[model samples]
Target: MNFAFTEEQQMFRDMFADFVAKEVEPLAEHISEHEEIPKALLKKAAMQGFLGALLPEEYGGAALDMVSYILLLEEVAKSDMSTAMVLHVHNDLVSRAILLCGSAEQKEQWLPAMAEGSVIGAWAFAEPDPAGLTNLQVMARAADDGYVLHGTKTWVSNAGIAGLMVVFAQAPEGPTALLVPADAAGLKLGQRDKTLGMRGVQIHPVYFNDVAVPADAVLGRPGDAQAVMAAVGDFSRLAMAAIALGGAEHALSLGVDFAKERKQFGVEIARKGAIQAYIADSAVEVETLRSQVYRCASLADQGLLDGLSASIAKLWANRVSYQVANRMIQTHGGYGYILDYAIGRVFRDCRTVEGIEGSNRTQQAAIARSVLAAHGFVM
Candidate 1:
């Protein structure tokens, strides 16, 4: 695979970076303090075709290659992770699912609206169980014309603002996905959670009491939940890895800049060995993570992304995110603990990388299972 980005990809990266610098970075603090991203910013991103970054042109999408999409997310994340995550769910998790698994009629119904940013998409997959995709508690009861969904989804990102949601529930055939309009009758949003990081995200518990939908609302075939999830999860994880890479790079830059400017004992801290070591370690991880993230992105573009590779990239990126952020805080000393500093916010936001998509343990389990299976250790 070519490590270097194509000319078009670089141009896209430049555009993304410039947009984020002018629009996103200035608002990062405000969004965190207010716990909400302004609708105007999202509209601007949609205008840039970021909301439809990976969709086909026929549906009003940008039709960008996966590498370019990764670059877009990476640039946005460098300025604000909340905005990046909002786009991630909209593009990678929900709209991409429809593009990949929805029937042509379904795509025709939703894709244009989604691309135009008239409707924002959300994914509702978790339940009381933290990892609810595999251990689903929601049930989809068969009805005369369609299905009636019952139960609640927890920690649903973009719940408050999503116009559409792809809700996962168990059907008679097996686990199934149903696209439900957010304003459907009997659907309710519980109070939003006050999270430690990514506070700008509007995560809530979504309750469904016999929420009914037509049979055509089903995404992909019945009993094909595993396949659909595998496809979506790989893409989402790769996107998360890109976000992590950009965030880590920003944190490392913060530390390096601080070290050069801060003075202790009549000299700059950058001259200290400990500070030098901290920056050195973080720089190495950031570079290594960059390679992994881009390679996986390229693989995705070539339609060769595998579960194991995606999991590995996500797990490693999660580690790098936390480590780099923590090191930045240490480099900041007492100033890091102060909320007035951007490092504190970055540290809090970076912590969510491990918990989202899948936890570190979740990634480890998947990796171990793959390795053991390859070694003929069958269950």
Candidate 2:
């Protein structure tokens, strides 16, 4: 039941915070306005060893533990949410998947370049008709030379920038994941698809029109896409919550500051009982969410994570992060609604959190199944 961060972990957190303060925070507005993350900033993060946060040291990575990775992501999100998300997709999703399931040859070929920021990574799981693999619109058919993947992937993060991608499609075997080079023939990177928020993040649609790849491109086992994707989902669920909590904490800070600074009726709004209550409630909620996320992350580090724990954390984040953002806006009144303030960006972004990864409704089903299984009940 030990709960304190180690000295090394604290140092890592402070280093990440300092990096964000100097590099990411200043560019938050610029990124939002321009809708792009400067390549230089990503290279700076690579130099800081963040791009390789999950890989083993042998792969030229920092080999950070789950807790440290979570901490780094939260701090990044605190300064810039889109930057945190791109890191999550690259480090937590793509790289972690390769580390966990990729062949030694695959690891040797990709990890070093990814760590060096010479290559960027993206995950293409969602589709125009995303039914997981059970009802995949994209299908991969085996040829004598290899496999040809045909279908469109929607809402793919880092699509335009990534030199490599991990793609999932239905195969002669069940669902299958394959490594597709960004420049592969028949692989078309569509224009950036705009969304509700996270403007700096480049999410796009990709049409895989008979893209062929060698047999060695298959990830994990040929028919093991379900399990591979499930594993990634657990990591993604926890990571999404950490990102959301960062937004919530930032929102609380904005609210408390505005409450203290904005005067009303000859006194500070901080003097108002309502303002005091919002601040108090937000602080408590944020701290509790933080603890839950860390606890889940700890379980993951210890190999104890399951869908249930991850879902609980995501549900907490999805429900409460939005509430906290709304409170921040209410505290700001007309100013919060204005897009000029960074808090407004947090508010817009937090709303979309409910729908990304797995939605709240989907998570509920997972949590329910796990809970029932804990008892003698079977579905």
Task: Evaluate all candidate structures by whole-model CA lDDT and list the values in order.
Answer: 0.91, 0.88
Please give the TM-score that candidate 2 achieves against the real structure.
0.98
User: Cα deviation of 84 in candidate 2 (Å)?
Assistant: 0.1
Q: Which ten residues in a row have the lowest lDDT in candidate 2?
A: 129-138
What TM-score should be assigned to candidate 1?
A: 0.98
lDDT of 2 by residue, 1-379 (tens): 9799989989999999999999999998898788889999999999999999988899999998889999998999887788988898998888888878888998998999999988899998889966767778899998998799999999988887899999988888878888898999999988898877778889999999999988898889997887677767887899999999888888888788888889988899999898888888888889889999999888888988888889999998998789999998999988898887778988877776787777789889988998898897989
Report the lDDT tens digits of candidate 1 across residue range 1-379: 4678899999999999999999999999999999999999999988999888889999999999999999999999998888999999999999999999899999999998999898999899888875555567898999999899999999899998899999999888888989999999999999999889888899999999999988999999876787778768898998999999888988988888889999999899999999999999999999989998999999988899998999999999999999999999999999989999899888888998998988899999999999999999975
Give the Å error, residue 106, model 2.
0.7
Off by over 4 Å in 2: none
lDDT of 2 at 336: 90
Q: Which candidate leads in lDDT?
A: 1
Model 1 Cα displacement at 22 (Å)?
Answer: 1.0
